[model samples]
Target: METISIQWSLVLFTALTGIAGWTFVCVAADEFLGRAKAAAFPAGIAAFVLAVVGGLASVTHLSHPDRIMGALGHPTSGIFTEAVLVGLLCVFVAVYLVMLKRGASDGARKVVAVIGAVFGVLISFMAGESYMMSSRPAWDTLLLPLGYMLTAMPGGVACYLVVVAAKAKDAQVGEYAKALLVAGVLAAIGAVAFAAAAGQADGAALGCVVAAAVLAGVVPAVCGALLPKKPQQLMALAAGSLACAAVGIVCYRCLMWMVSEPVANLFLNIL
Candidate 1:
């Protein structure tokens, strides 16, 4: 494999979109728990926008964007699989949004929410799994998908907290902030451990990755959790945390890309 191209479009698609989808799940889960409807509309809008942006970013990865339709013919291809999942996810979110707009019954909304959330999870899985290649030891571990899932947890929580603070003033959002802080710490530790185990055992890049994870995830989580439980205070904390966590996720992706070393399979006997 040649040197990996670092494209801003692909980075946005993989990290931001993954976080956005996971945020949908978190918002829906809060609703399912019988929380107030204050966040439903905003969450739906966010999900739809993220899906659209992610799809467009994907298009940028194609050299001949017009030929992208040809990808559909190869259903087994990773690119195709991601495209289909993202498309379906967008549809599910749109359906949910439509139902909300029309003032649909609670039962109908719940069903659509479940469908959207499920598709969101599948999209995150495909984002990481798409990079799975045995030739690249750094990208071959199950840790890649697991790391995405873990990081998404705090990102989702932080985003939903912001929505809740702005729209609902839900006191329960603080609890989520606390939970996310603990989760962020755990995720940071897990990330470094996984990186070390997966051919990045020791290097300046690994150190940078570890530091970013702690800063991007752990520190914000701690601050958010420590904030006063007041709705207004929590909201401010959440906003700050969201920015930090977003930066952390981007750093993690860059490090993962940097660590990708393709194994050379040269047989001297053949020569």
Candidate 2:
């Protein structure tokens, strides 16, 4: 397999986006449950800030960062459209945090919760399309978006479960942990199916598939299953699995960048 320099910017952006999205979802969950802890505020703030930074880094990867606003103005540009949606979602999250700090009424918080869920789904879809829209055979799949959403949900829940586990003596962290584990497993399965369906028969492509399978499938399953025994260990496991998933994503992107369409009849002429 030929090694290429991975785009560190994309990697950073994707990783941070995963973490930030998880944070935002956790905060939303806390609000939904009527939790008024100060820790929720800090998590929400961090998530909002990180999400904005991640979105900004994504723009910097474009050839025309200055034209980003114009890209958003274009109706046909899916990438730009997604970027705008994510930006809006981040703004909403920030505003939601502000309202929480100000002791917003239940009715007002509920309104924000509804909006957050909508934007959360939108952001998840856009994140999936970030890879799925690529010409690379390895990434262009309907399952990509669903898998991204699944993976993100667990991460978000895991973060929330951790905080709740620490603070609430009577809280059932096991339920959240179990939910996260299940989501991770489903995402891993979807990712594996996508890789199998799209992978080339060549050595490089085969190597990529094997690497992705180990990282995205096997590792996560084993680690996720161990969550019930040790909560702290489970947290570490979740983090490790998430990291592996991120690496698999990067590798998948690299493979897509490297692979090219097979030329017809050229081999016949050579023969």
Candidate 3:
């Protein structure tokens, strides 16, 4: 295999997007559990920051950032176009945070929540498509988006659980934390499985699969399963797992980018 430099823009973009997606998930899960008042504003702000940073990094990969507005004007560009759409979604999230700080009504909050969730899902898919759209066999699998979604959900939920566990005096919050941990574990397993299967056929892909499995699966499992019953331990496990998932996703993206594309007409000469 020939040596090549990693695409720093793509790596940074994926990392920021993962963080943003994870933050949104945690916030959404908090809302679902009736902790919206506490989680909503902070998570919204984090999401907005991450989304803006990721969006800007993505634009850096383009030939012209000033032409970004013109790119958004075009409606038929698919995932590339969706990049602008996700950026707009992040702006809405930022506005939602402002409204939240100003004491929005329940109805308004609900509307923002719904819109944010929709965009969260869209961003997740857009991240997956960024790689899957490439001709590389390592990333063309249908599982890529599913894996991304799974990792994001667990990472988000875990973060929310950790935050709640740290502050809430109520026993009910502990139960919720436990539940989210279990859910996160399951989601992590699914992500590891899908990534493993997707990478079974190629060397670069296999390396990604192994790295992800260790980070997203084995580490979390050992930490979460072996620790004594303690809130702090659980929180630590959750945070570690989230970190692992993020790393795994990055490795997956890097592998996809590393795969070499064949030159036109080279196949004819080889035969």
Q: Using lDDT as the measure, which candidate wins?
A: 1
Q: Model 2: runs farther than 4 Å from truth? A: 1-15, 34-38, 130-139, 159-171, 201-224, 232-271
Ranking by TM-score: 1, 3, 2
TM-score for candidate 1, residues paired by index:
0.87
* Selected candidate, larger TM-score, 2 vs 3: 3
Evaluate residue 166 in candidate 3 and report its C-alpha lDDT on the 0 to 100 scale: 51
Q: What C-alpha lDDT values do all the predictions have?
A: 0.71, 0.60, 0.60
Q: RMSD of model 1, in Å? A: 4.7
Taking the tens digit of each residue's C-alpha lDDT, what string does model 2 give over 1-271?
Answer: 4333455566556545655676576666656665535556666666677677878777776666776676677676565666766677787787787788789987787678567656766676566676654444555777656555655555455555445544543543455556566755765665566556665525766565555555655565566577667655644665676667556545444444344353232112111
Worst 10 residues of 3 by lDDT: 262-271
lDDT of 1 by residue, 1-271 (tens): 3435455666678776677777788766765675647787887787678778878887776667787788667888777888887888888878888888899888888888888888887877678787777777778888886776566667767777777777777546645766677758866865675577676545656665775578556866686667655455777777877777777777666666667653553111221
TM-score of each: 0.87, 0.75, 0.76
Per-residue lDDT of candidate 3, residues 13-44 (tens digit)? 76666557666655655555564346566567
What is the model-wide C-alpha lDDT for candidate 3? 0.60
